[model samples]
Target: MKSRFVTGTLVFMLVFGMTLAASAEVTLRHWDWHQPRMNIKLKYMAEYEALNPNVTFDTQVIGWDDYWTRLMSGVAGGDVPDIAQFHNSQTQAFLNHLEAFPADVFDYDRYKEEIINFEAAYLFDGTFHFYPVGIMSGLIFYNADYWEAAGLTEADIPKTWDDFVEIAKLLTKYDSAGDIQVAGFVPNGILGVFWLDLHYQLGGTLYGEGAKTVAWNNPAGIQALELIESMIFEDRVSEVGFLGFNEAMGTGHAGMAYSWSWLGGELDNNYPDLNWGVFRLPTFDGKLAPGPVARNNHETGMSVMRSVRQENKDAAFEFLRWLYEDTDYLIEVNLVLGTAPSNRTLLDDPRIAASPLISAIAEQVPYTNIPGEIPHEVENDYGLGMLQDLLFFGYPAADALATAEAEANSVLMERAVKWYVEDLYTPVTD
Candidate 1:
């Protein structure tokens, strides 16, 4: 067998003749936090280079902690990679850096039907800025072994919020002297997932859907925040401060941890022997809960930068297209990154069928929705800051949420005015 590098080089040399233009030569700079999966990245990069020899890739891997800072600097400096990986939380920061998905760029309409359940993730106000990379759904993950040790069965899983609390109390373990041993449930300490989901379940609206006003201080909002406070103060489940989901899962300190599909990969890496399964978070008051859960999960997504040269744009877009349309490529990403694929067609892949964690997310697709894209500065910088203060810090939930709503409204109004002045906000289509 040929060495890996030689094999890769040969593969690309063969494909370069088919897809690459004679005069085209492009280089792409990509940044992502998958240092552990460099091999997988190299494999895909090699294949992509072969298909488009005229397009070359130069990658830079950054840890998730520093990646955002570096990415923000790149955006501010107007220097961005043609194709870069992005998280949902970071999507808002780069919206302005993305150009419309031009017809010359790709055939959106032809692939539209193939990309069901993706409109909210990539399309915004009639402008399509991203080829959505993956979709994430928040679910409660339970350790099967822990539940069994507690004499609980699959049928014992909670169906509603009240039921969940009771089950959590039951599964909670105490040492001989009555000291807490293991927690029954640990909600991921994310304001958006943990607190926001609670707020939605409690029937609170963060902002008026039309963006006309703030409305997070309603009864439901207070109720939701109070419930979270009680989970920490009253129930005394997990530790008081922010305990990361990864650490909670790795140590098996909690029977249940709320997280997205990413947890599947983490568990495999950190606790390979643990038997875990996922279930939907319980609803509030048992009215088949709505709001946050139903609102859509892809408000944050990756986008192709508009600043890249035309040739790199085409190559990067090609890679993105393959990622969405190819089954093997999609599965590889799911396996390596643990993020669910945005492409609807990949849902039924055999690989997903074999993995319960991935299948759980796939099964929820019909029920999933995207929050849709909004102005980045408003949602990312201003909104998340208020969220950190309200949820993470000890701020009164009502006042914190109310302030966040006001700040969000202010940002929206400012963007609207600018769009009007620059004539960039015109409705090109109905």
Candidate 2:
């Protein structure tokens, strides 16, 4: 059901609407990086066009790798799409170029209250530059067949890190020579999210007071690295690169993998026959107290460009308001995202209530921290990304974090957050 947050504006639109003739037609140019999402958006665009006959869409779906390059260059050349996809990670880079939610068109306070974690967007500057469609957070997706074969049941779902380790051992398979053949839990590509989740769970923060430098070399950080190191070495439940995460899971060689809710859509699309089950990330002490279970990353649909002409901008905002106000569209797109709606109104909808996967992820929303953008090199190449390699090469936990700290700080020095939200890391004390 559409909430009162939007129903009133929708009624106002209908009551004071004017039909635009073909002579005054408008074509809003839109761009996004995901083909599946674009597919969903395109379907809704058709519905939008039917309602406002004079407004049509010119859309483009760019490859994710080339998306920002093409977009930044386009913006610099004064050829920016009227509406472009947005990610909070790009807030520092594109915040100025994006338009805030127009006060006349949108109630800022309503959005702040209606969205599940609107405070998560403190990193997106003070403006609602993008429409946050959903929030993405980590989850452990397991191979259902493997779980059954291991003689596990719903009672076996892990509630804590210790429980996960035991289950992973039972799910592991060994080769003739005793080397691992099938992994019980794969951490491939987890990178920053994995590191940060574990770190935060134990009361670590990524930055110090000024947000000027690294603050992740402390006790909690070391413990997080130790836990991962032990998982790969002493526990031996998983090999560093055995068959890879998604590939192994798809082929039934891996029992579980650490990934975001978005993986649901990817796995469904790419591995149609794989039987899978997901659980929200396990906690440190078998409870939510000490810290959040995981960190969340906000997902945006389309950010209107502040640089666009008035007519295109007005039309773009009008269409976006209508697009989100539709209940069916929200439900379908939430399915496409593999998450329940970010809109609080749809949380109790039958579709979300019936899906175990969505329900599990939704439970974690309130507990997840929206740790601001992790830098590319900091998360990937020379920082947390290198921890596994360091661990594989026999680096001690403290030394591994020290190594990552130095490498990550080099990037932090250059990419210090322009603004930092202390609440982003404030733990759930309850």
Candidate 3:
């Protein structure tokens, strides 16, 4: 009887161990900077957990301004999250710290065919570190009421830079003190892509052969800068040193501004009653250029950290696959986010194609240029500052652009040397 009792106890202990192992939980920590989209992500997270009961999510949404700083800190301290969202423009900065997604994580041929501009934006060093969440395009957002008040219609929308300035002059309003009460068009704040787009529109490229030289000091760039100068000084339609000019455009303080597709959603949500319309930015020669010439592609995506444990990495990748591959979920999330679809399939979906706003933005996809796959923040900052000097401090456009080119080139050369030494400068190939 004692021997029988011992055997039964052993069997019970074995069964208990098996149950504990089966119930073991795997938690994936995620980080993203888009605080407003947390609820949408959380809903999907809950759905994913329901499907895989053994997995759970620990998600944190940080403010955009502080996010990069925090992320770099985490990377430096070796406390990075399992998965994180990063801008495509900033991905080059974190390549060494990120884990390249395995072949099975996503089907390469299908992705290249289905995602718009994926190769230009996300493909890096012969592999993809992240899956794009959305594609954003630089666009012109105009206040419809203000445009009409200036006696302009859709038919009157400018088709060339000369026509644009003329319409802008008509839209300007001033206070008793000669201060700009309503700007015709504000070109100076936050939106950094204006000059870049203008450069491309004029048949200019930012980088030269081998992606190791800066080419913005050429004729195309000079013409772009001259036009911007003409707006601020010659036509006097746009003013310098105006803060929050982009937001003011929505409040009817401005007629038009260079902005992104995301601005439409923000205006709709924050000022639902405001009447606005979207348009492609005018070209220098009054003709649409082919192949991403008038717009800049600003896309963001998700990547897994190299430091995550094997089991957690598997769970994280599975979650990403489900997040991107599920058509219904992708549509719902993007609808809430109000971003252009990264998946080309969604671009053809009747749901997306039918929306006037989405259609308008999507139309620019083929004409947008993704900036070079190099560290560009420094270049952008320096160029913008030089631009401000031209607009606000009366620096010559030629001088400012030359200075910008020199400084930007210096940065590029330094980065190129470092990347080459580390064997990280493998350019993406067709």
Candidate 4:
């Protein structure tokens, strides 16, 4: 059953004149980061069904931990669904599984400004792979009570790493037995995004255009690592990996934690008693490091399976346009799933415009930078997690970055070599 049959009535709303059959049924299997939350995914599916009356959306959600694995397997086995959400990082692997089309994919030029001013991570030689959803950027969340206890007001938030160190020091408190009661900061989790952004702020580039090599050994990289090290070692202002990032942020164990805006709702909902607010990460020498952009900052997007028949392919993409470009559908995503719509035109939708959490994220759109556009996949792999765990175990900053860089480059080089051997690409080493 093709989805067109199930969604026949909705065709009336489309500018096109084709009407689907009443019994035309297509099951759209869409994959995303989390198993769709009860109220959220169901609400959208119900709305889509009501509008179309002919299509059925069968959503197969994988958790963040299992998403990549499930997606990669499906792709490799050619068992991918009608559509699935993909991260900007996962675009390469999934692109090989997507159907190609003529240039005009929803008038890309018309939404040029909405392209999110960073290097398009999903582009492989200018062939756009995924339809971006929403924006995600780094934010520094502070426990206001802790800052006030340290005799600092919201006005005292630092603008530089140096100033932040001072504030962190002031906020750190210890019990008589020498156990740290409250840490000035927590430095893991999404703070990893801060790693690349801060490297640029510290004056380093991961890759140079002419040379397809990793350049993390530069001075800026050293400085960035040193800054994180200073907070844990010299200043004793942070509890690196003593607890999970969420736990630290929620329980008031940390004064500040670098996280995404989406966490604001989680904090407000779960920790109802915690007094906190969000701010952009501090800058260096008065210049702010641009925040990293994600495919969707809050909620993700779906892509069609390359193996689906051409007609089904068209149907999948048509549904995608309706799901993403349609204002009503986009608003439903925001309202039901806590997603900030990526459709530039939806910025005015009262549903999204009214959310202060989503709006705060919207405010940072001008500062978003997509992470490295290199084709190799990045594995969170507990490197930051392990490094933070070992911070208290006395690992030096240089040693930590050196070890992590070596491992990271090893993984990346392996992939690069594989792609080269397969004639998919080549490295430009100088």
Candidate 5:
């Protein structure tokens, strides 16, 4: 058996086309946060190992909250995985330590032409360190049992918000004591994001002239807030102080939920017994969906490490090239992770049209706006987070919206991200 050796870094000598001794084996370590996705990766990695005959893997899954912190520590200690799974939003935290895709090896122009919103996956500085595999955006997720008990079917999927409100009333369940048991439509924790979804549908802007700060206090935005108010307060189909967005949906206490695509995987992982269905967030015009319907962010990335030895770096990228370029793997990632594949080629594949969750996401791909990562404070505290203040405390929607606008602008102006974004699709096809 070949023995391990080190010079400046641990040398695996696993370069492409290099002959390996029969007994010599190398392990490539990879780290990610999501268990559902990692399951898919592990399956493929097993196949990769079989084909190579001398490669094995050390796969690690960390919780989302502590992943970055742990990764940062690993980098500083000079003990890091050869490949790190990351979200595009977390790039600035680790970009300097990531190896850029070699210029001559991969066709950059083909990536641009073949991938949807390719630019959003990379930095504005023009060097590509991370490549996003797919995108996650807002969708309407409903409990199928509740839907059927309410005498509803897929034919009842709404063309507009007005139709959706009527359906929400049907899905809501009231107990014998006359208290809400199952809310028809619970925005609870997700109120902020779906609110932005509606605001964009109504032609509102998140920032002002030069994109320096927030400008969400306009007529369209206030109208969107008022609509939310009517649904929660006037229609009586939803309630405040209910379980949070994920809890309600996963536990079957919410008849319908407005959340991102990842909720599908979460529900699958945590609540496998749930009977759920998905539809695109309804349009405002009662016609085809139009531009700027929802805000989306990049998801699922693999970064080759700058710290790995030269031979290991070459091996890692070679494996990654196979992973990213493989259409079957691309399709499977979206299926398991509930994301829309970034590969434009997948759009025409029959598999893309088969999965309801992925199809909903793919249909809206043309209409999404990626305005970088929204300031967390604005999304959770100052802006969309103000829904409770309005509904529970009776704060006036217009005035509260104005205050939120001011606070969001303050936060946006101070944020490090430049706020420019890419638009990939709007519901133009079937």
Candidate 6:
């Protein structure tokens, strides 16, 4: 077997062919919302600059909530950074403003096999836009101590929705005034994504008529909504009108939560004393589904903007090529974020495979799914907003889902017109 360094060197040569001599100095502006990984980015940038002394990076770290607004503003003004973070959700919204990865410079065909879920994660309109670094999948994190307290063990972990609800009920605790002291579960923490997962597990579809219409108003959707309602209301295992449920879980006030892989890192860093275990989301039945149980892919990637100069774009691509080929860098950055590395080769690294929590996250990578290319804001406005109503205001699941479906259909219609009609009407200047 080849050593790790030898393997990395071989991969590096296969990715970026014959290094060219640096001529003119170029400063590429790089932007990302992963503020937590700022130091890692800087470290990599320094190393990259050392490799090509003429190429430098101007890195900017923005907050997640404000990143979109800033990105949109930059896009409108034709001033986006040379390289920036690209979310799977925002791909449809900024498709026109982004630059497709040049096939000549980046050997996508060769590299695709090295990355996990490459086809599902980043391909759009027969073009690739981003270099995916890691993926964040939904996971059920339970406090092992709380599980033991409830007289449960690894063997007692839930295999079906019903079993999970039962386990949640047993783990719940109440205060003197009949208020919950410890929540058994927290479905509201990942409401929209969880709902989509449940919908798919129950054999539901989100799109209809060739993605031009919404089809989530069917029986499967209704059942998914009703289940969430029951969890928050009838079962009372999960508290209604509660936020920070994940934090509560970390503090031992909540027994279980349906959260993304990042929670594993958070627990490791913030609640080191808390014993936690992770499991894949239980299915509707007691069996694990053969494929993905969800529609949302929380994978994030880096992309070059169309507005950047060709020289700068080339520089940016060089850095990206090195970043993706460097297995150590990819693994380290992913470990910091508590996510599974998009580079499939690093998935089974000794460090990741040794840790049960990280290993559990890596296991779900193959079964993860990406959402349809819909406008990102539509889900937040129609899907998540309506679900919140059912949870906090006691709206009937049927009524809430119907209203949400109607609103979502309208949004889809608008998107259809923009893509099929309005875009055609606008003349292509280039």
Which candidate has the highest TM-score of all?
2
Give the TM-scores of the predictions, in the order they appear.
0.75, 0.91, 0.86, 0.78, 0.88, 0.85
In the predicted model 3, the residue pairs found to clash are: 292-367, 292-368
Local accuracy of candidate 6 as per-residue lDDT tens digits, 1-430: 4698899998898665544333578898988887767788888889888987888888898888899899999988887899988876676678787888888877778667887656655666657888777777778889898999888988998878999999999988999999988889987656766787788677666666566776677888889988988887888987766646578878888889988878887888788898988887787766544545654354566888988898888888877877877787777777788777777788879987876766777776665555546665456876555666555676677777777788888887777612221111111121
Give lDDT: candidate 4, residue 208.
40
> Candidate 2: where is the Cα deviation over 4 Å?
1-23, 122-125, 425-430
Q: Find the candidate with the highest lDDT and give its number.
A: 2
Off by over 4 Å in 4: 1-23, 36-41, 76-78, 101-105, 125-127, 148-152, 188-193, 208-211, 239-241, 268-272, 289-300, 328-360, 373-379, 382-395, 417-430
lDDT of each: 0.64, 0.80, 0.73, 0.61, 0.79, 0.75
- lDDT (10s digit) by residue, model 2, range 153-195: 9999999999999999988899899988778888865644587
- Candidate 5 lDDT, 337-359, residue by residue in tens: 88888877887778879988999
Query: Over all chains combined, what TM-score does candidate 6 have?
Result: 0.85
Model 3 accuracy (lDDT, Cα): 0.73
What are the clashing pairs of model 1? 12-50, 88-300, 296-369, 296-370
- How many pairs of residues in model 1 come into backbone collision? 4
- Evaluated at residue 40, the lDDT of candidate 2 is 88
Best of the two (4, 5) by TM-score = 5
**All candidates in order of lDDT, best leading:** 2, 5, 6, 3, 1, 4
The TM-score measured for candidate 4 stands at 0.78
Pick out the ten consecutive residues of candidate 4 with the lowest summed lDDT: 417-426
Model 5 clash pairs? Answer: 365-425, 366-425, 366-426, 367-425, 367-426
